[model samples]
Target: MGGINLNGLFIKPPSSLLAEAYDALDPNGNITIKWDIISWTPDGYVAVVTMFNFQQYRHISAPGWTLSWTWAKKEVIWTMMGGQATDQGDCSRYKTSPPHCCKKTPSIVDLLPGTPYNQQIANCCKGGVINSWAQEPNNYGSSFQLSVGAAGTTNKTVKPPKNFTLLAPGPGYTCGPAVVGHPSKFISQDGRRVTQAMMTWNVTCTYSQFLAQKTPTCCVSLSSFYNETIVPCPTCTCGCQNNDTHPGSCVNPRSPYLASVVNGPGKNSLTPLVQCTKHMCPIRVHWHVKLNYKEYWRVKVTITNFNYRMNYSQWNLVVQHPNFDNLTQIFSFNYKPLTPYTSINDTAMLWGVKFYNDFLNQAGPMGNVQSELLFRKDKSTFTFEKGWAFPRRVYFNGDNCVMPPPEAYPHLPNAGSRLKFSIFIFFMTSLTLFFLFE
Candidate 1:
């Protein structure tokens, strides 16, 4: 009777049914559950649940689960079955064993319900939730579990290295005479005045991430005599040789002739003295005398590695000037000039130079490299003696070199005056000695 009833009912034992259900519900039995905090906000956090060995239990739906954060004292319940569900008949009702499933492959479920609980939890947290998908979280979950098994949490934090600093061309850095120009008002129109100058410097960053990022930038404000008016040249005449076309011979040609013959080129024949006051009247003659002439300038720039720990792979230096057209030569052993020399624009003249490989190879911590630029005008007899202008914009790896108060004019000796002074001193000394001996 029992066998006949069992065959008619087609019933499986209660123990066997319970065992199957238990194994299906146990994550370790047929599936593995991995829980991770994918992202979070100040109020709440988002968790991810992954299931492995999902194919083994293709008939079973993903179990309902609960995620809890101990710090915020919050809990989120996810009741959706198999993450999605269809109104299919029960598998136990069929005699063909386990029934077909909605999701038959391994799956991942983002546990963010977008509910008030998630929002409230996020608000309760101090800082915004950090996404731990790429990195581990600083704070660990007190306890985490899926309906099937408990999951582990990765609790780790990352700190960035120290920031990089520019040491060589520190604050108030200046480049000496990168551009040469006359310091007088007479040659102002000739563009011999140092209108602008540019300087290059060194920069560094501690993080390696800077390599691929945009280069750092710094602003250097230039304070110069940009607004000063050009002083007019003093009035004078060319001694006996009347340069003006106003046809009129000197009343006393012998006096003017004697002045020119005695003055020569070293002395200013046009200068008025009390002895020649009568004959030194203003004449309508313009002497094409190039006064306050500046012939050449030596520009020196130094780049130093500021960071003691980091080494530079390569670097670019750019300098701009308004009067760079006077550049005659470069004196540098470490740097190489870039192509397309002296790029000119309406604003200024740009010079790009690169230092790498051999230059950087030997440059260790606190290493320095020096470069010199020689600027000259057409005339070799004159130079920007009073003081040449510096560059207006100087950049090192796109960082500007700052300028302090303008320095005093460089000491430039006048060759003609120096020779004349030496002669006068020798003559005076000989005369004094002769008188003393007599």
Candidate 2:
């Protein structure tokens, strides 16, 4: 867009003609009223405009003082009202006073970039008498039309969206929800909820051609904050002991990790069995991973059925190795499960199940479970230079570890158990059928 009049368009109304009301008209209905742009700084621009009023029969100042050229399209419509004639009965024709209050006012607006702009003036009054006044011969009224100015272009920066937040457990929380695959949290008071979030864009563009106008735009930013809530501290009240929801023998009756007892261990009469008959069954300690967007997993394991011999001599923990199939013994008196279960090391040992062995066995005098020969893959097979008795904890392969494929029926109960009895009856019936057929 080019600049308007170099010397600036200035208008000095003739003193002889008093400021009076005039109605402007044009074929296009209401004409747009605007002052030509006089001048402007490199940074800012100014525009002048006036509107004709019917009641006073003269022009008046329009509400929006700073006329914006972009808004001109919607503001140009005008109207005119004519007054009654002396004859009283509807005077359809011209009368002594101009009945058309806005009749003489021109409604069209035209902007010129350079040549001095001109305006035509005409008077409209109550009685219908139209008085035409002098204007530059080629033009219309007593209005001073000035050229329109161009608005300066600005380079705006698009702002990004606010960070996404997981609302529960409140903000600034670093701990994540348990269970890697589960949804982390529900919506909280502050509106933070789901961890996953995304951003969408909107743009305004003209459908048609060259020289067409387009809307300015910006970019959006997206982010998220993850918070974790510890599964409501598992209720210790009911005395549920197993993390896996096992049946009988409440192992680790106080731990939140143990789901529940699936079953109990052997009942031996020899040992003073302080059988926690209904317990949080010991989990074959395995790693439970919590994953965020990042790759690294926070691994944790909870060992149930930690038999701390009342004699304070033996400390035994049945743990499910990280790889899943292996069942291993962690400690036994001469060996204590990773650091004698001090308040501090208890948490560390649980989470370090999957880390390097040297560090894991560093539990000092507490690292037992070093007996039993490896029937299959043995930890000792790997170099354990840092002075460890057993290469890796070992267990009875035939008894401790036998993972049936997913489709296989789980272990059957002992003989005379419900399943065994059912099987016995079935075989007997088959034999009887064979005899009958014979």
Candidate 3:
């Protein structure tokens, strides 16, 4: 280079910004400030203060000293345009005396699962143009700053960091609507296979994703089958015929079957209407619930509506969880439903309820009851909010047996009795048809 004279100078150092207290974010992606200041004047610049890293330094630049800056580490003069150049005794090269504390960046920390955190960085420069630095943690955490300039400052923030927690399906969960039969029914078709069913789950971003990925199909392994047989038409007259009725001893309407279930949440009631047919009885019920994953870890489900209907019609329900064992329960109030009927699940920390009514053979009064349950794990416990009922869906499964035709109506010996039957025949016929089609 030809002879060059310097009028002013600036310096730039490599620096980066990083989360001061990050749980697991790497340091490379952060931004940093790199800068230096200088002056060139005949007085050789008497330094007042020195700022290392965040610290400040003496006054920079003078009337005669023109200043410019670029990314290059060394000073690059744009032109010899300034007045007279004077020796400034290298103002950029100042040293601190006495016991000096080494320059240090902000402190940081590693984040933990489900844990909340707070972090901040302060500006340390004494004077000069300093830009505010940006901070971004792995979780898009919030940022704050501390300053010594103001006496009292107030801040308003919304949605502060929340605590972390893990949740699971309540105790004793199982899969319903297995390939073969109801809960008690075994997979006789296959080997005496003892499947230690454990729940597993995969999340889909959209409803389409759930369908495309076939999650419902893949999750079948978590289900189990059971046996339930519907008794063929066993007729019983409830005696109430349409107009001009004639009541008899044989035609009596029995009380409806009551179903009560107690689980993690609470108690729920269901009234099942009995439909006695010449060959069998059938009922339909549906239930759906959305779980709140933010609430608790485990949940429980218990069904108990099989008082009298159990003897005539065997029914069962299947309970399932994403990452847990499948439980199957028989709807026989006389005894415990079965081992497979109850469950608590944690597999994918899921939320939702699926109802498969009389999965094997549908024979019974039709209706259902759902209740809240409580779950516990370690020191934390969870329960459904008080008195919330799981919504129900009522429809017949395709496999359930239909009621008998009305042609099999009981024949009477006297015309009066026959005429009475005829009077009620139209109404009775309608009732019979409803069951048959159902």
Candidate 4:
């Protein structure tokens, strides 16, 4: 028999395809968790765990990352530096100086800044906030040291942790099982000495926008000086403005209780409480074709926040357009070129300048920041017609925004129609002259 039969139903081995998270602009983006056993203790071992954010634009923000995993063989944390477990689960078994954590599954968070000297390690603090590899390569990783009591002391006896999970303050990342890899090597800061670890393992995690949120956090609008019509963000691009069913979904700009609502405890919740608008999006990106010049063209970009309670700090925007390669100057924002595709140099990462526009404030009059870009025109491929000046794609804080339909974009005035009218006028004038002369 090819399969087993139960109650007239044939059963066979199970198999199915797995769904994966992918981004066209950032196809190779991921976070790697590395665990290296630096020393062997009497009972167990001491290991250093580090996290590296390899994504091009995505970063872990304040109230930062949380890393968790299930130990393979009854591991208990005896001591920790640079980070700590969220719980001291059932340390009651040890009466005198109990283990730092006594749990099979543990969640760890990075120690905040200004930690005591004894508790600090290299790349340890900053509240677990990590920038993307492209934006801040120097600050792209976080590290912590931990001493385990029950884990095996020898490399052969030790096993890797399972079910690793990463929440960079929130879900969207899916981690794979930790597997042993080549030994890790460490070098002294002075670059004079080096040391090698006895064992090492790694866990890689990928993010999925679909798993993160159903609705987009931002939207893009378009406008041009040549056309009077402005294409607005798509209606309900983020969510519908439902009042009766979900009273707390959004707040009116003029609501008297706005202050109390925004300052309430629920303000810190994961879901954003945005200002009521047609788009109902927390953030809006407006791109305007401001001016046209002989050799260079100008475009103005504006980012506005509608969230009542939250402020976006260390935020960044990514834009893709053909003219980015010829970009001359950006007015206020600091920019860095991102060459994810390698062959295409059209992507750019822009962020607010520190101490001025770095912090995007809550929904109000002062909630927006803007910058203007000047780009040298490439005569071979440059054209104002058919919305050629508009960006091909836009992303805010690494999350893609919904773009308005191409047909709705403002079009150039019909030059062909004017030419037709001029020809008809000339034909009428010639016919009148001939008839008069005859």
Specify the highest-lDDT model's number. 4
Give, for candidate 2, the lowest lDDT window spanning 10 residues.
215-224
Deviation of model 1 at 190, angstroms: 54
lDDT of 1: 0.29
Model 1 superposed RMSD (Cα): 35.3
Ranking, lDDT, top scorer first: 4, 1, 2, 3
Residues 1-438 of candidate 1 have per-residue lDDT tens digits of 121111011111111211322221111222222233434333333342322221111111112222211111212222222232122223453355332222222122223334334232221121112111101112211112122111222222211111112111122111111112111111134444422111111111111212312322222222122222222112121123253762232323345464453344534232222112122222111111122225655555455442222233334345555345556666543332322232542122122233423232212333555455565655633334433354444544433343323343223446786799799999999999999999
Error of 4 at 132 (Å): 1.2
Local distance difference test scores for all models: 0.29, 0.22, 0.21, 0.87
The C-alpha stretches of model 4 lying farther than 4 A from their native spots are 1-21, 416-438
**Please, what's the RMSD in Å of model 2?**
36.2
RMSD values, in order shown: 35.3, 36.2, 31.7, 10.5
Tens digit of per-residue lDDT, candidate 3, span 1-438 = 121111111112223322331111122221111111112223111111111121011011101011111111122111111011122223233353311111111111111222322221222111121111111001111111111111111112111111111010011111111021111111222445432111111111101112222111100000001112222222331111222452221111352322321111222212222332221122322222323334233223323222223221122222222312221221221111112112434211111132333223212233343333322223232222221222111111101112223232222235676578777988899999999999
Candidate 2 TM-score, C-alpha based:
0.15
Residue 28 Cα positional deviation in candidate 2, in Å, after optimal superposition = 99
Which 10 consecutive residues of model 4 have the lowest summed lDDT? 8-17
lDDT of 4 by residue, 1-438 (tens): 243222121222112112453767777788878798999998899999988777889999988999999998888999999999999999887989999999899999999999998999888888989988777756778889999988888988888889999988888899988878777667666656667888888787888887777779899999999888999999999998988888788999898998898888786786789999999999999999999999999999999999986789989999999999999999999999988778889999999998999889989999999999999999999999888899999999989999999999988879896688789999999999999999
Worst 10 residues of 1 by lDDT: 3-12
TM-score of each: 0.26, 0.15, 0.15, 0.89
lDDT of 2 by residue, 1-438 (tens): 221211121122222211221111101111122222223424322222222111111111111011111121111111111111112223244344522112221222222223222322121121111111111111212122222122331212212112111111111111111111211122333454422211111111111111211211001111111112122211231244453675433334354533322122343221212224232111122222222222121223322222322111112222222222222333211122222222222111111222222122211123222222111223533211221111122111001211212222122234457677788899999999999999
Cand. 2 Cα-lDDT: 0.22
